[model samples]
Target: MQTINCPRLIERVMANTLESIMISDRRGRIIKVNNAFTRITGYSESEALGQTPAMLRSERHPPSFYAAMRAEIDHRGSWSGEVWNRRKTGEIYLQWLSINALEDEKGYVSHYVAISHDLSELRAREAEVEFLAFNDPLTRLGNRQLLMNRLDQALASCREKGEVLGLMVLDVGRLRPINDHFGMRAGDEVICTQAERLHLLAEASDTLVRLQGDTFALLRHSQASVADMTHLAERIIKDLSRGITLQDKSLLMRPSLGIALFPQDAMNKENLIQAAESAQMQAKSQGRKMFRFFDHGQHSEQQRQLIIEHDLGELIIARKHTGLELYYQPKMCLVSQTVCGAEALLRWQHPSLGWISPGEFIPVAEQTHLCVRLDRWVIKQALQQIKSWQQQGVDVPSIAVNLSAHQLDQEDFASWLASEVAHEGLNPSVIQLEITEGAMIRNGEAAVALLEQLQGQGFSISLDDFGTGYSSLSYLDSLPLNELKIDRSFLQRIDRDERSLKLLRAIAGLALSLDLQVVVEGVETDRQVALLSQFGHIKVQGFYFYRPLPAAEFRELLDLQ
Candidate 1:
């Protein structure tokens, strides 16, 4: 190597460096400071020399903190961190400081060289950009970006403190319908109303964020337990469920609240959101006007549902051969014990996992939009079964398969049903499509009028879960329905609860007055059966007799008795 002037090269490099490098003697007096030091810190070497380094201390740092830093540098020979310091003219700035101990020939401490970079403008720019990026323009609350950041910070805090934080995903419910039905001006008014409500709901320390599409998030630094979060969730439900008035017409806006708590729901940001979102999803799935907290089982259950959603299409293809099977539970005449029909339930017999219940896969099918295909399969299978039973000298009434709302939403719904029944060469009267009372509703007159065509096709229609829907009795009076099935929930409580008994009696009386047959469900006890029998409306089914049984088992029963 060429001969090099090592000491001169080091001094020149230090003088030109972007950072301010200064040397202080063991007594803490500045011995020398470089040109960069004068330029950035606004102090000339003549002015800074011989002065104590204390002149640069901003006093924001605790005395003990500096003492500890000095101790670390004395023991370890170097220290690095962001610190507050003062420049000339008393301007305070953030400084990234790094100090290295200068050694003597004998390894004794000789002096120290500290390099500092001014961070004032940089920090200000950062804060401004962060605010622009993460704050909502309208409400000035945290936007989705800040909500995400807040969640991350909360996750980190939870990791350190071992406490749970709760996230409430709030949806502004009535805002959309009002905006759509009324006007955009009404929408803005509704949003402002909700933003004010959100501000009032949150503690001063808590962050309320405006997520997109009129949704908001309220973040809580919950206590160690989730009980506190649950109590808060209930309070939100009660508050948001109250009515709001616009132009003196009462409008209802309820939150579909989903909560996620740390450690219990999830440990990380993504997972915590998913847990909260999963709970909220469950709430919305149940009809979206209440609070739902994350349950461990719900998390695992959602995972299982996701797996089914992804894999069910493939599962359907594989099972299309030998694994696909249908089970039917009999719906009998109340007193005759004669089967009126059966509801088809899909079962998957995995080669390794054995049978999978409809309860497990049906929801998955619904979520993945696979239910339409599954429904098609059920229709073909049920008609074939009815044909087989008819040929075997056993009388089987019409077959019923539960129709999902998505199934009805298909553009070819009535045509598809007609085509499927025709392709199966089955009598239209032998097949009945059971639509939930909720799903049977149509917003457009064209949609409800479409159902009138289905009624003309020699097919029977039954209103499922007749009492648990939004339609008034007057609305029901206009619809053509051959039968009405009382929800299992009402009849199950009739034997023990007076309120339920009266509700059931009223429903039975109304169905009869409308010239409709009523089917009571969930008759698990003989007393329940006797009560329905006494009322002369004994058409029922539940665990009292049998859960759904496979075709083979049900066929064998037909042979035995």
Candidate 2:
């Protein structure tokens, strides 16, 4: 091994090491400093040379702190601990400093050596970890853990002051569908935008928190009365009602708020949150842009819906179609008095709950991607049933399956649907896709393009519940559509109001002039059928002809036809 020069090796080590090193003479003035000292303190050796350590003293430590450190160094000849020091630029920083006294042969202190390690980076990392524990990384809002902590304190204060505390949970209804239609980045933008809006609406004393995906909470301790909470919820709804433009595409976020009061809803944190969440579900079930307070009577219904949603998720995960069945309702062509097509409707028979209404469970499914999955399942089932009917020698003309807006928004939905039909060895013309006008309006131009793609594949597209939505006449001309199914509401008033009758006739005439097929739904009376027959070549679907039946029964009906 080569011999190492001690002095040269010490100089190289001092120059390269990250820890700042300083040497002071017995007179207590800095005599030498390593390169790290200048780098860490923004001071060159020349500037530091004749300066005492007092030059780096900060106001954070009192005179006694330094005095004790000096005493320890004097008695024990060494001291090591954290210190607050000022850099050459006058910025206060933290450093772990270790000092030792160097003595001569005479046993008297001659020089002092000090090593400093910057603690700024370490301290920053610690703070960041703590922050992430309590805040949502995406929105930078308080998370559930922080919310529960704040709630406990707020409730304690409320109890002492005899005041009420309101906890409001707001659910962004269309967020998941937006994520599915747009991208996850777009979904993140929506969430951050909503969080900023909520921050602006929150009172100074109110604590805003992000619970999880598309759900946020606000704890209001001041002005927490029913009237105050109502006003806040209205403001939130109004503020969020405006469209958020993402990538030049305008998207609307519908908010549903649920409010639960302390002592009234529940005294504990968990129960209070549960009550607020239950109320939020109820608000969503009622409609979009709605708010509701916790009601004991509706709790059971909300629980049932929760169970339904959970069970639906399980079924989708397991790919089990146990209780799910597609019922066929025949559509009659008045001109031929024969079934022209059959609308496939979904029905669920839960093992214990028996038959659950679509109205009850569909909204629950719509809250998540379950609705999209449900729509896909319906499409597959309809196609398979059509193939089965054909194999059984039943002459079913076409099968109509309802599509949700979420399904239409999917980037590859049209291709996937066409592939499904082709997989069944059936022509696309045998399948009819029914979409609501609201779905078209919500999806904008994308929906129209998807419909055109499906139509180009030889599939028929029908605008369902026509009069219930925007009903833009422009859509009638622009959209690639084969049929229009008028909502039943229009026919309910037809027998009593002559204007309603004239309006129906005008709509039917306009559709006929455009060479589009027209179907009137929910015809329950003979008088209504007689009135509808005058419309000429229109199809009718409702209880008047036949109720929705199982596949076997529907096959029998097709056989008789």
Candidate 3:
């Protein structure tokens, strides 16, 4: 400290610093520059000497900008701010520049010292942050934030012009299963492919956004008519329906679209998005590649569903099963002309809503974790009821319980069912598992494997609601099915429609040839029953014999039989 070289230390510090340092005389001619200045401006110290800072000026700043900077420096004796500067290579870059004036003993400016830090990296980082905030990382499409901003602007413009705005929310079906089966990379490929296809369908005025996983929104900035919206929806569905090839394997995508109109369906951005989402839910429920328009009636139904979902969650959290009941609908074998088995149907009686049908609440449950809990509850109650009936000498041969797709997704479902049956001291064959084709299709090979595991454990597996799904015949031989329950739609006109009757006969015969038991559902009239009776060795289940009844009533009926 005693022998510190002050001037040498200052020069070393300035040379070592990363910031570009420059010095100019009172006449504004370059006098000195540090190494960083040469690195930043691509100029040698010899070439820069005697030159004014105007050599580094960029066209980005107007003449007024330079005048203001000069005024600030003259008034304050210093200036510091961001400046656009040009390099010797003619490349423009941003820099944070600070200049300080040095005065002599006479109190007049004699020299100026300037320090500059390149802002290219900082500016790039800021730009990247801004882009990510408004775009989906995977698809590089506008995200929900950008969508909201554009939607607000569009809505304001539409209100002023007295024009309608159409908002379409689209969902890609079965994407979750794809992600579960194949890896997430496959899922990303599918999402990118769909986004490209949707972008291709978009017009220049339209705004396409990726709201979240497997969901996209399209804002119809032009031609917001009902017919135009419908046509766009149709084109989207058809285009997405074509199989996307991933690693030489073709993956099919079914897109469902929901259209909601501004001013008619919703007046605000949030409400409009919700309306479109609700309509999309409806479209998915109706079928794949389908589109639905928003209606007040559907909105009311959606509100009720929300209430039901909330109440169901409360019941689940409280572990309250008193409101949940299982009704038994008897399945009679035509060959024996007696009650052979009964189906356990779930019913809920909400304290506030009075009675909620399965048709109304089941779909809602399927969308949440409530479905798995509900399925387990149904199985446990059915098993306990069967033991109670047997103890009372009610000779109910077998009981069928419907399983949700969520239940099939559980890895331990088969083992859990086996343990439950064994705990009740009942043969596994006494319990039949009724599964919808849609459930099997959703779970893919996993469902088939689960069914085979259950069958191996002596549990009977019946394919429920057949002929209404996509691949019934293709699955007949592969699925470990003991019975096929023909859907009621096939029998709605069986009494008068000869083609339906013949088709029903063909299905029954097909099941018979495969040595599988056949069950015909929805035989409402004696004529339908009489026509179905012609098929040998089949079971009939519908209101024609008996509607679903409470357990006590069902036990009494079994006792009478």
Judging by TM-score against the true structure, name the best candidate: 3
What does candidate 1's lDDT look like per residue over 17-70, in tens digits?
888998999777899898988987788999999998788888999999899998
lDDT of 1: 0.78
TM-score of each model, paired residue for residue: 0.49, 0.58, 0.62
Listed per model in order, the count of residue pairs whose N, CA or C atoms clash below 3 Å is 2, 0, 0
Top candidate (lDDT):
2
Off by over 4 Å in 1: 1-299, 316-324, 348-360, 442-444, 497-499
Off-target runs (Cα >4 Å) in candidate 2 are: 159-161, 176-183, 305-561
Residue 90 of candidate 2: its Cα lDDT?
Answer: 94
RMSD of 2: 9.4
CA RMSD per model (angstroms) = 11.5, 9.4, 8.4
- Global lDDT of model 3: 0.90
Write one digit per residue (lDDT tens) for candidate 3, span 1-561.
Answer: 589999899799888999999999999999999889999999999989999999999999999998998899899999999999999999999999999999999999999999999998899999989999999989999999999999989999999999999999997777898889888998988899899999999997999999988999999964599999999999999998899877788877888999999889999999999999989988998886899998779789779878998998887767887698999999999878899999999999988788899998888888776889888888999999889878877776889999999899899998898899999999998899999998998899999999999999999999999988784586789899999999999999776789988988998999999999999998888788878888999999999999999988888888787
Which consecutive 10 residues in model 2 have the weakest lDDT in total? 297-306
Q: With candidate 1 superimposed using the best TM-score fit, by how many Å does residue 154's alpha carbon deviate from the native? A: 20
